[model samples]
Target: MSAQNTQSGKNDKVDDVSGIETTGHEWDGIQELNNPLPRWWLWCFYLTIIWGIGYSVAYPAWPLINGATEGLLGYSTRGEVAQDIDEFREASAARDAQLASADLDTLRENEDLFRYAVSSGGSVFRNNCSQCHGSGAAGAKGYPNLLDDDWLWGGSMEDIAYTVRHGIRNDVDDDARYSEMPAFGELLEKEEITALVEHVRSLSGEEFDAAVAAPGAELYADNCSSCHGDAGLGDRDQGAPNLADAIWLYGGDREALTDTITNARFGVMPPWGTRLTEAQVQAVSAYVHQLGGGEEPAN
Candidate 1:
């Protein structure tokens, strides 16, 4: 060590105590060792750098001004997904064709088709209708509950299919089940609106003021009877809801009823015919029908 230090350059320092070469730099009392890297470790690092270069050249890499670089192999995630979708559609072509043309009234006679429709409809409902109607199909405020017997429109399988295809109060379809309630805010006084609220409460068997409800009987007869009927049984032909049933799309309370009488409800549903395929519309309609609210076609 002492002989090597004598032969070393002026820049190379030697530690006095250990008689070993130093890097001519120290931190406090310690000096760093300038040892050569292990040959195996160095080779492994070089291989990794080579692999990275090769991977970049052989695969999608390097973002350009317009798009990403395409490799020689020309693989794409979108192309792969599209191929898988095409294959799936081809496999189900027979079933889809049968479903698209099947009659809703007789579709249930074939157990296999019925089961397929129900399952497929459930998937469609979750994907499209669940945002408004709820995941469980229980519905929310202003969205009618599907699990109950009460229905604004007829709930027969055919009726449901028509509704799903054309929708309610939608402007896109000419045959959409159309109905409009005159907004009574300008037509009736505040007291009349309040009376109507109390009367509606009474019709639903809720607690109400008999005095206010008495005046509302005449008011309801004159204004609401045309659509809602004398007993508030609701006319499905006009899409009028049963006020006596207590089940409401919106709340059945005083505040909700008052607002409804004053402004009137103008709920709109988009025609799914424009968006979903015919089979999907029928499937989703069938899905909603079997949710326990479906009714038999009128004899």
Candidate 2:
């Protein structure tokens, strides 16, 4: 009998032995319904099961005395990873060479090169800066926004390079840029601090006592003006905050402002120059510049 005829005969005999009748051709009160599994599908399923058994035996599927079973084929996930990294390096050699050779400004002019830097730098930012700056680079209180063009230190490629090389408040750094916003807690009484807070708050049009602000004016010049500037516009070189701006690192609330004055807040940004290569630092700065709201500063 042909294969088809043999299968049909076996199916026909199944109904009688199983005590099931065929829908049309019943045998011994046994019915064989029209439902039948495809031969190819069943075979494939069996083959996959057999393959799985063989794979489990040959591969590192089971844990042993010291480690997992080393596959007979000697396939290793770590080896595969290393191989992938080598492939990546080989593929990106041209780009890496360009980055190494080119200045940050020159690289930024090339959109493709800039994009490559952003992708590479994004990984580094996520690993390091994301803790304070957030995954989106939106800063928490006291931490400045990386997305914005506004930088306490200058935003130029060279400027960023300098800041990253020598961190603010990084005392361990021999060449660290240092500025201390004197604590007003000892200088001013509780009521006087409240007046200054009200005055600072009024700069942004938040609720404040005008009468108290008048008195606070003199105090601002005496203590804060040395760094924050006469107009309260801030001195970027000194890393002094612009009290006039709507953007507040700490909360703009009266209590927060009062606290800030009482015990001056110093925000510290870690230097990346020590940890990362020059090219890597440049890439990160470029990526940060691409974050929304950043713009080229006037020469």
Candidate 3:
């Protein structure tokens, strides 16, 4: 009734059929064969070890206390990339100089330079201005549409360039374009604000209760007309938007209009003068101007 194998002595014997030695280890009376690895595979394994050692000595592979080990070749991928960038910039220097200095009025005469500015500016816009202005430059609720003629500031290339360089309502730059709209909720009663909102809506041709808008007209004249103009045409000098036009920055809806009047809006744009090169500013301006909204410079 014993469970142990009685043929344990045969486990270590060479297989007579295959003439191969057995490993002497067995499971359930099965024996494992002892076989050497192929010579080609063994040689490949040795070659890999040699390659790893050679690579460590010839390339920047090992880390050191302060930096990485400058291998025998002393090569750096980052340095090579930087060198390539410098070469590219050097090649484009002359074109950039022309773009930076060319008068805004005369820029259109040089077709090649104008095209270059627009192309370069498109790249700059994507990197810097696209977050707020959108990839297509259509703009959002609070942001002004670059494809429209309703510019808060002037729409000329020079004006656009100036605005881009100095920015709007940012405190960091002293030369930044600044404007403030008083929060009328603090100065007027709820009834007066409601009436004024109706009157403002009427200016844009929105249907409103005639009785409500009548009182609102007086309130608008007393509080908003100076900067917005008596006809609501807007003053470019003060950066007042044309309320009569269909374009609305925040929204033209009643609730959105109410919130804007109650809280007031002070949208701030970061100055790009300190952030971007003068040439870059010019390029971006050109790109924006060509977006079908730009106007001829005023004589």
Candidate 4:
């Protein structure tokens, strides 16, 4: 009977128990039941396709030859960020102007301004000056230690500001602090230089050969005393470093001293006047002055 029904085109079957229709197509006599999708699920799938098309049309979604497509809204995240940065710089301009105009003396009187300068200067130092002066500004072999009272130029606020702006022995600035120490290796005999090194070492209370240093004292008086002073108390005007102090810029070791005398040490610091704004120079100077090494300004 099933075969007669199938041959008579009545094979479109229904499950009598469930009352559901089955697809007429069958494989190995196993027919497939036809099921309709839920209405809510179909609606959700259609809505997503519409949302995607709308989003592509409104925002930058397409690629072009030179750039991305400018969508209907014409909005950009980068443009918004640039605008925000511009606004921030504009807001800070007035404060920056005030800082630039204020002198070191005036800045010190205003506690708020002083604090601001120090904070801002710290950031500037870390970014720009930390490469040579270390992150803590403790200095290295040739760099001067900023935490100590020994300043090759001067440790006063004004002096520090000047040095920072003009720099030392840098050719970039015409008015840069300039000084030169003659390489004594060419002028003096090796024995004489050796004696001078001993003399310099003895000035700092280091043990030295008395016989060698005695003759070295005469040489120092004739050659170094004019700038370094008779007592080795460095002259700021001449930029001569003090030999009497334990703080050494290069090193206090025998080899370091011998090299310095033989070749002469000429450490160069680059001028910040052209690189940094006036406010930044002032701020950094103030920050350095407050670092427990600054001296009272000479009256």
Candidate 5:
């Protein structure tokens, strides 16, 4: 009788209305449902699993003790990078080819090529030169402005190229551009330096006491006129700065002038020749020359 009762109880546990079974667990007298997953949800989950397997087989996805998977296609990140570079070079092949053959003058003559070179060179300049020459190319108190007409060295395309290729004041390089302004303080007396400063101020048409500059004129001719010329126009090859010009590479202040005379300042621009390829140097030179205020010097 007990066995029959147990069998009847098991039959009673099954739902009569639906064939779906319960979870066989209950909370607070409520049984949990064991419904099948929705068709769409199940399909999406299956698709992801299959896609993950395919991806793992096709590319480097698996990890091992030594390295990641080689995958079936045998692709490499380095190969992809090289391919990208080759594609870019191919697209700009004409410009690159022209740059290889063209001289600075020829490159400057072509408006399209010049524009392209300048744009590229400007970015390079900012990376390299902006530390000394401000981002705007205005330059610091000690450095010379690139945009201004006043250049310590000749502003010709070749000159600019040389400066970039071999940096000035670079001790490591023997070919680096270098020039030292004379330390006049060692040679001249305090009164004489004062007079000379007054004279220099007069040349620039800045306010200077005539009494002071009168003594300074004699000092100027004897000491400064050799390299700076009698009129203070300066020597291009020697990179002497014109004293008569309003623009001052270093500040025009008296203290600044005194400092220069006391201890000569050597502004060094590195030579790009050793650091960059010929093509890159050419591009940079062309860009600097075209920066406003550069032109053919009067004969």
Candidate 6:
């Protein structure tokens, strides 16, 4: 007999013991039993197939060239998120209006507005300003640190706001605080620049060779004093940095000072006035003002 029940001849012989019709095909003389599947199991299998088809039709399914099918319901996660954001913006509308118009001078006097500004400004700073200035506003070598009192331009509330509004050394805004330091490398000899570097370092109370700094003084008086002042105390009006103080923007080392004087640093800051909203500018100004470096407005 074949292993499978594929016998073609009429062989409806009954098993002598069970009296059930047997398949002629057999293995080792054992007959095969013919049975039908349980009705319950077949019904369950059909129901699952129907459910899958219905689900695919109701929701997003089937990939297309442009995108997935939008489905009959037309629901989207992006739309839900946008709705939530719109609701939040609507709730803050009044506060935002007050913030936009409030005077910067007395903003801190109002506890509510002050807190709002600082909080909002912090978020703005992290999002926009953190790339240059650190997340904590400590700043990098080229950037000015917000935590310290040292400022190239004045750090008063009015001054900070003005700088933020117009920026420094930027070409986009005509009102930007414009000042240029001549690249001494082109004008002065190599020895003269080195001597100037030594003199500059000595002014900060660092150890220096007096012999070399002697001639450098005359050079500094003629070339740099007009902007840096006679005592190296820096002129805020001109945005010249103070050399006499210990705080150094780039670095205090010989190499750093040498580079600055030789090639000069022409750093540019973007004018926030054109980029941000009036309220946003005010908020960031308020946040920076509270950072310890900020000064009281001049009397």
Model 1, residue 131: distance off in Å is 1.1
What is the C-alpha lDDT profile of model 3 across 29-86, one tens digit per residue?
6767777789999999999999999988998999989989888998999999999999
Which scores better on lDDT, 4 or 5? 4
Reference-based TM-score, model 1: 0.86
C-alpha local distance difference test of each model = 0.87, 0.76, 0.89, 0.88, 0.78, 0.85
Model 1: per-residue Cα lDDT over 9-59, one tens digit each: 533465555656677666775776555689999999999999988877887
How many clashing residue pairs are found in candidate 6? 0
Which residues of candidate 5, in runs, are more than 4 Å off? 1-94, 297-299
Top lDDT prediction, candidate number: 3
Could you give candidate 2's per-residue lDDT for residues 192-227 as a string of tens digits?
A: 888788778777777788998987887777777788
Give me the displacement of residue 188 in model 5, in angstroms.
Answer: 1.7
> What are the clashing pairs of model 6?
none
Candidate 3 vs 6: which has more TM-score: 3
For each candidate, give its TM-score against the true structure: 0.86, 0.73, 0.86, 0.75, 0.70, 0.78
What are the per-residue Cα lDDT tens digits for candidate 4 across 1-299? 12224556544376444556666557786666767779999999999999989988998889999989878998899999999989976986787788899878667899888898999899889988989999999999999889999988888888999999999999899989999999999999999999999999999999899999999999999999999999999999989999998789999888899899899988999999999999899989999899989898887
lDDT of predicted model 1: 0.87
Residue 270's C-alpha lDDT in candidate 2?
70
Q: Can you rank all candidates by TM-score, best first?
A: 1, 3, 6, 4, 2, 5
List where candidate 1 sits over 4 angstroms from the true fold: 1-48
Per-model tally of clashing residue pairs? 0, 7, 0, 0, 14, 0
